[model samples]
Target: MLEIGGVSVEDHLWGGRIMVDLPLACWVILLLEYLDTFRLEVELIWPAKWGLVKLLYVLDRFLPFVILPFVGFYNITANPSSDFCRILFAIPCMGIIACIFIAEAILYLRVFALSGRSRTILVVILINGIVVVATCCALLARYIALATWDIPRPPGVSGCKGTFTDGKLVMIGYGTTLYSGILVAVLCVYFGIRLYWSRRPGRIITIFYRDGTMYFIALSVMSITNVVIAANLPTGFRFLMAPFQGVLTSSLSIRMVLRLRQGAREDMGLTTVKVPDIEFTPETSGIAMDVPRTRLGA
Candidate 1:
């Protein structure tokens, strides 16, 4: 049996299958989720308003579906050309990049709203987030640039047959992601603490904190696991967790938007799910939103 990276080539084929199947599985589950909550989205987000947040939501929600076909194509297209594999790989990776960037923007809006519209907080976040995301983008380009497809793969082998020499670049990109996610999570916690100390946390505040905590915990664990895998594991398993990361981040981030709107106290002459004076708009379909206004003593 031929060995690649001390693992049998047979196992490597399985990894390729997993890479294709995992994302397909996630998409099926998420599509079901999207359908299940579509009523909520229509009611809570669709009619709220058009804004950056709505745009982010749409991209985060639907972009993965666009990339799913490419994933399947890359994995199942037997004996594809190096150029074809390169193109297919880049398509899905680029879509993932867009998904991740949109997810970050969504998180940024969440943290900003939690800070009560503090200009100081917003600017600080701008600096940190720019640095982290920029680093990630640069490293991702390097990783993809260095990646190669082993043409004429062994008989009975399938998939893109792609591998990169410097998995460290990818590990570093995810490391930056981990750092940025923790910072956002910590900020959410800080604002939550402030709200609790000041008075009874509003219905939305309690919800935000609960969801934010869970998001961060899941993000951290997945990120660390991804980094570890990228560092120490064979290419077969390096990105096995990427699908899960995308599903969790995009799904929960959108849910945070929807749930906040669904639970809003519309009787207070308020519209939109907001924190303090910060008016970050999250959109779906309906749910009776009024003109977005400053809430929580804005």
Candidate 2:
């Protein structure tokens, strides 16, 4: 192993090169994105009036922004051997799983509204979502159990890394990737059919079309990237995947919520959009409501 100015080259898992810099950059960029949009998040989904669904939305959208930075900083500054750091690691792990839960819940509500609140559709989607999320949690548990601290990097590099102890654990990640990709594809098809039938799409349907399509594409790309990285990269390098995923998940979830609320505001003659009920059920609970009003459209 080469020594550079007395620093051992093997001190970093990725040769102490650009790979060491990437996660820091990723954290900075993701944190900045969260900070930039937070004002709008607060305005639209104010906690003062948060219901159960809105509460979940807050946890999904903001929790990553809050927890990830701690994880990043800890990885850089704290001794991994310390009991406290190990204990603290649980926060991000749990936070990440919680965020996924909230995001999927929001997505399910969105589809149910789009499907005119049909009981059959909601039941099917709920069952599928539960299965998918439970599988993800099981995989995540394996990952956490097997996770290891990366070799400490030199100054100016972050080292918060974790990976599966067994290659089989990676197949679980592949399962998650498949689950996410399929979910996004189905949403795309749902919106595509809705857009087709509308013929003359209104502002609301147009918003849903634009937002859901772009978000789906973004998620699909992320899922593909996760698969590639997990399949090809070393276990230490695989830690890179979750930061990007967390950032994208938070941004998409919060932004889509903002857009839906924005359209609802315009429809209601409000100057600034506040959180409207995106998760609406029909009066009869099983009856199909009018799609337009049930949707976030005018």
**Candidate with the greatest lDDT versus the true structure:** 1
Q: Report the Cα lDDT for residue 176, model 2.
A: 69
What are the Cα lDDT values of the candidates?
A: 0.73, 0.59
Angstrom error at residue 193, model 1: 2.8
**For residues 1-298, what per-residue lDDT tens digits would candidate 2 score against the true structure?**
5532334546543432434365466567767877887787776677336576577776776677676665555455534553455445666665665665566566666666666766887788777877777777777676666665544544554444443465456556555645764675596467547534645554555665576666666666766676677677665455456666666766777777777666655655544344445443223221222223323433
TM-score of each: 0.84, 0.74
Candidate number of the best TM-score: 1
Global Cα lDDT for candidate 2: 0.59
